[model samples]
Target chain A: MVADTASYHRIVLDSRPAGRPTADNFRLEEVAVPTLEDGEVLVRNHYLSIDPYMLGRMSTGVSYAPSQPLGEVMIGEAVGEIVQSRNKEFPVGDHVVGQLGWQEMALSDGQALRRVDIGAAPMSAHLGVLGMTGVTAWYGMTQICSPVAGSTVVVSAAAGAVGGVAVQLAKAKGCRVVGIAGGSRKCKYVMESLGADACVDYKKHADSAALGRAVGSHAPDGVDAYFDNVNGWMLDGVLPLMNRFGRIALCGMISRYGDTPMQLSAHSYLLISRLRAEGFIVWDHLDLWPQALQELTDLLQSGSLRSGESIAEGIEAAPAACIGLLSGENLGKQLVKLN
Target chain B: MVADTASYHRIVLDSRPAGRPTADNFRLEEVAVPTLEDGEVLVRNHYLSIDPYMLGRMSTGVSYAPSQPLGEVMIGEAVGEIVQSRNKEFPVGDHVVGQLGWQEMALSDGQALRRVDIGAAPMSAHLGVLGMTGVTAWYGMTQICSPVAGSTVVVSAAAGAVGGVAVQLAKAKGCRVVGIAGGSRKCKYVMESLGADACVDYKKHADSAALGRAVGSHAPDGVDAYFDNVNGWMLDGVLPLMNRFGRIALCGMISRYGDTPMQLSAHSYLLISRLRAEGFIVWDHLDLWPQALQELTDLLQSGSLRSGESIAEGIEAAPAACIGLLSGENLGKQLVKLN
Candidate 1:
């Protein structure tokens, strides 16, 4: 008799809806795990990433990163251990990173795969500070903004995955960093826990113009570099207040990610005025990766950098995890695990 | 009886108002010509620049060059003879360049004044090609964009003041210059007369998206550097077709200069998608001006660089001339002559 073997759960994109995403759009399905190919590895996902940028991928629209097609496996990066390996470069029992989909068992090519080092850092951190989040912060602050010592650097979404790392890195470089997060607790975490010079609770600010004024108030020296993750209104304040030749490293626009098509047309002042802003894809700077990784790894090794992971229990909660990610409920890095 | 006190005719901004400038917005007034001071020279107005940039001066907004306040003499550059001089550096009858008012005679400190020998080139040529217009084109194209030989360089407002010089300059540098102009006549002038590599008639080309496709057809290599003068919707089309690492020099945005307030929100797809696009005021590179001026002057002397101008007869025609300049009706540098 044939073996009765199947992974009994899958999160399917149920429908393409308007504006913000809802729990109803994602449907859970029972499915059979596929066999691995000759040159493939089978991975049981240990963690799934929940990023604001994922909200961009969920919608079918034009963006720097192409969105996931409706009814397709929602695209994201994940960390897991290799259950079976047929590729010469990879072996069984290896802790690996791959886009293994929102499922229990999946096949992957050796392409874009890297072994996670539990000795270098914690296992869960591969989804947060040591992974894409850490790299993004490293690249945006150092490469895009390139703040000098004593320059006042401001980062939005301060307590989130990328913001937390950027704040600490900027602090290490002698820059005075200000973070804008959602709550007083997050603000305290940014200032005391992450070494930011100050943090603003944007939710209490009432408007972005007011938030910008508050940021300006904190840095009487004028803002030298603005690391923008949240777009829409708060950016309006910072743009006018940016010092001459000030640089804005635009990593992502989380606020506008889930809005309808019409929201795209309301902000031209970003380009028209005297400000200079640049957006980049991470892979574009592959040559800098080794150096960046070395520097960040050194910082991690010395305990100068700290990280947090909002770990969800299993593969079944991935949909709710995504919803929580978009709503800003998840603190630091949001990750999902399945055994 | 009043010792034949010299009075000169001038245009003054009567009051700041909303929308496109009208004849009534400026008033013709007669003012007493001031005597030269210790470091000043008295210049007789031979020619006055009537540029589209002046349209912005009609408003009270901030700019690289401060705006002229209401009841103040409209500020501009003039190519005039040093009819009177108290400054030992500038002797009378010397052909001088100065920021004299829109008047027959005026007093000015020797700041921004240059005594040019018109035996090599026309006095008005200095005002257009060898002066600010020429310097703007040279700096914006060579220094900012850095178009290499064999790259595709696209220029908008092709047959106008800056466009005319940019075409010749790009061609001289071995770049294939494609121009976007308004009509068949301008297209013919841009290609046949000024020697543009190709010309695109934006008005005849339906939507800007289709226009971009057509322009790309001629420039299969895609755009290398975009010397932008006209912004708004035309800018929308050009943004998508630029090659990776393409440079855009924002010297002027004529489309947005009119009195009408624009709800100018553009999509993320417009500009941020490009790998590199930067904007700067030309004066930021003033330290290199002496070298840039010497190089351009050498080109002008050798007939390698050229210029074109559209001159209006009298001071009364200045308002209509400015309107025509805004509408892209005049090709080359639009100027008003007062003998």
Candidate 2:
């Protein structure tokens, strides 16, 4: 069930973590359903998305979104069915996606929620491939990197949500795609299932130099465009191998989001290579979202694109799932099935 | 004299250096001036420009221009009078600027040489302010960064060739310009002579954090656009204090050029801030040169632009001058007066 009634479980931010997040940072509570106001709808969240970007919001540092306040319900995105609707636009049983936080019951004014067609695709996909992750991948690939045909494009975190989509998209565009993943299983998935030309297991190489050599073996002509997801040692490994006039679309630095003072070197490569390194937030490019979504939807319908989800069974597992996602334990889009 | 006749003196690349270049890397030679071929002109180079970009050419690494081959006439730009000509375009005594190398006399095919009127500007000024430095400043400021009026723009190496012109241009565009320079004297010149709103001495700050703090005090609202001339510590110092959606036009990485891997951190800040850093070789933007030169010429003619030169007398002093220029020992455009 993607909807429920009466009192529901919700997770709230208890305290901000100093380094890597722990289960202690979140508090699970049972709260009574709220009375809906005019133009409001009550949603029972089905699947809550736990993205790498959320790690930035849980800290005191600056991010695209405002930091989550202590004791407030943790901010997140969820695709859920409307259990009760005071608004005429969203009828009961309609699936909707919104920034509804980590909760089984969410009260929305209908302005934040967008109704999704459950018949076209899986309800959970509205939280992953058919949603923000897809849009992010499309935007980064098309708008930022814009890899030319036959050029080599490299993506980090290849088996994960955005990277997976990016690798497929590059392949679809008639470009050679290379992926950097953590383990053998993910590397196999990236190479076999995702159709990447080659996959470099970053874990197989102990240090950055070894990692660089490993990545280079796959990209003999050097990287033409890069879709960077994991930014510390992975980025260092890719920098020297980057061809002149390479474009790097900075998606996420999941390796060092919450952590401050990362050890880095690449200023000379960036300048000497005449590389264009542009850091962007997907939210900033909302105007392009609808078009991106349409293209992503068409690809999905045509079987040209594929998506995977690793879902935890309940809301109680969210904190652990998020921690596991950051540690590279979860594959694809890590989510919590809250219904 | 900045021009000579009998047995012209020239400098050649002796060997590539591992770290910082020395006088041994450059060899002084006395050779007969090449005879002007058909469609060619012999230029008596009055002033030889020694720029930071040359350091990249001296090494075997990939750069904008081809690496300087060993035992060859060192590739460089110079402005001088045409002493002899077989080309109709460049008559005798016409002052022309070309990639004429580090020599007293050069044989150019007339295509490389662009005649500069000494009546409009001084001959040496063609090598500094009214030349490539001016064009570089114009391109980076106007085309790349594109700082809006009333915005705060910060420039590093503010007393040097490109940064010096960038500050004045920013001020002329109605921006509150702040400069970062090496010594107290250079800081004073950057502020008073260049009309910068504020100037910070990077030498005074022992660390990047302290330097960031010092620079931040001048730009209370944070930097809107940055013209980065020096990379490494200075870039790290500026990254944290940068405003959201800020643009950085990377002109050079002089600090890290010819140096081994440097310690750098700020990938997280870059992503969070949504900054756009683009590095360019100005030579690629030759299409915009005529328009840029015209605008710059008008600025110079109106007395809105001021230029300075630190000249090392004679071709024998060329090696020392280049060394001094790289070490930040000389202010403004460091040139060798070879006449």
Candidate 3:
């Protein structure tokens, strides 16, 4: 039988992080579980998502997304099973989705949460493949990038959660997909599993233009769409090689996530050259979420696409795994699993 | 009597310019003009427009408008009087608008030339406040920018050909206009004559964030519609200060034209901040050119819009004047006088 007394854990933002976030920026505390209201669920978070956008929220500097406020719960998404429920609409043992944040147990308002169909896929898949990152890759490619069939698609940070899914989606659209990952093994996964036409391991090439040359060899006609998950010197290479009227959907910028804000050269030439570059927040595309969910679900169940989680077990290990993500040490989708 | 034999002058693409264009990049040559054929009009140029985009065509880089074919006459708009005609549509003594380039006289197909009504304004006004530059500024504000009355409108390269007209057009639409130019004299003209609410001298402020700080002093409320001409660090300054959902109509990057191919940094922050930036080619908006001409002409006649022309005498001086434009040596509009 479950214990009557509720226990919950919260990782709070202790201070604004300087450069890459360190363990000191977060404060983990065990508190009494909040009482469920009329429309609330108690989710025992099995997995928590650790994304690059968390880097932007840690600083007050200008970013494509808003900053994370100090003294707040560190923003995140968690996949969990409901152990108790107050309202009939959400019954006990029903799997529920919510802004579970970085918590072991969450008492959430029915808002911003939905019932996850755990039967369709593993419950943890909700944190990666069929969750926000998957939806982000889906909408970013189909809406912003809008690559036509036979077009060349280039994605940076190709082995990460969103970039991995983006490669598969572009391939499904009949696009020639090129991915930029960190090393050989991830590069192999990008090509063999994600269906990327080619993969460029940035670690292997020291030249600033090496990725550009590789993309050119794979896409002789020039790239029609670029999914930017890493924005740094690498953008310099992609700008010159994009075809006229090409589209760029900016999803993340993981390369400059650490240290002093680096001096980044502008690729404004794309706008003048008829290149359409747009940045979108995944939250803004909620209207298309249902569509994104259905499509990704079909891809996963049919075995056409698969997802991998680079999981760090235990709630206390979340901070280190987050540090690992910033350092680009984690592969696939970085997750912190509560054991 | 003026020479009746075929006389020629060229707007030579002498050398690629640097920083802002200077007189050294211009070279003038005299040649024998080809004899006029059937359906052709031999016109003597009375006024030529020296515009910002001309600098773009001279550079060997990716541009929506193709770069100038080296060693050829510079492309530009001109007001010319038909001296001889072989087409029924154009006759001697008719003042027509055409792509006369930067030349003394042009042998035209009579296909591109359109006769202007002298009753509207001084025919020379057609080269300044009524020509393509005028249409470019007008349509960019009215159609693309769509600024409402009291909207904070910001135009870079403010004391320039298109910016001069844009400041007035936006002010006419009841916007509080701010201009970014180079010196005190141009800044005075932009504010005192062009009805701009404020002016920022870019030369004095080397730092873009400082320029934005200066702009903030005049317009306490953030800018709404941004008409971009000189894209570089100046744009970087305006980005952080922009209000939510502000519209940036990407016009031209005059500052980048002269530099040997280098990466330019347009603030990518706008994309994630939900600000809308659209790159527009005036040719793509040609359908609205006639409507633009009418509105600007009425404003000019009403004394609400003002124009400045640095008229260079003789066709040989045309290239030097074109170079002066990029250097910010010319106030208002740069023009060539041939008649």
- Indicate which candidate wins on TM-score: 2
List model 1 lDDT by residue over A1-339, tens digit each. Answer: 112356546577777646677888787777777778889987777777877777766776766667677776767788877877899788988888767677666678888887888788877787778887888899989987899999999999988899899998999899989899998888988898899988888988886678878898899988888888875676666776677667778777776766632222222333344445666666667788777777888998898899866878877799888888777886688888765
Looking at candidate 3, what is the lDDT of residue B329?
77
Interface RMSD of 1: 4.2
* Candidate 3 lDDT tens digits, B181-286: 9889999988987889889888888687788889888788888888988766777788777776677777777766666443334355655565656666767667
Q: What is the CAPRI rating of model 3's predicted complex?
A: acceptable
Clashing pairs in 2: B1-B339, B2-B339, B3-B339
DockQ of each: 0.32, 0.66, 0.35
* lDDT for B271 (candidate 1): 27
How would you class the docking of model 2? Answer: medium
Question: Against the correct fold, how does model 1 do in TM-score?
Answer: 0.87
The interface RMSD for candidate 2 is 1.8
Where is the poorest 10-residue window by lDDT in model 2 chain A? A1-10
The better candidate by lDDT, 1 or 2, is: 2
Per-candidate alpha-carbon RMSD to the true structure: 4.0, 2.2, 3.4
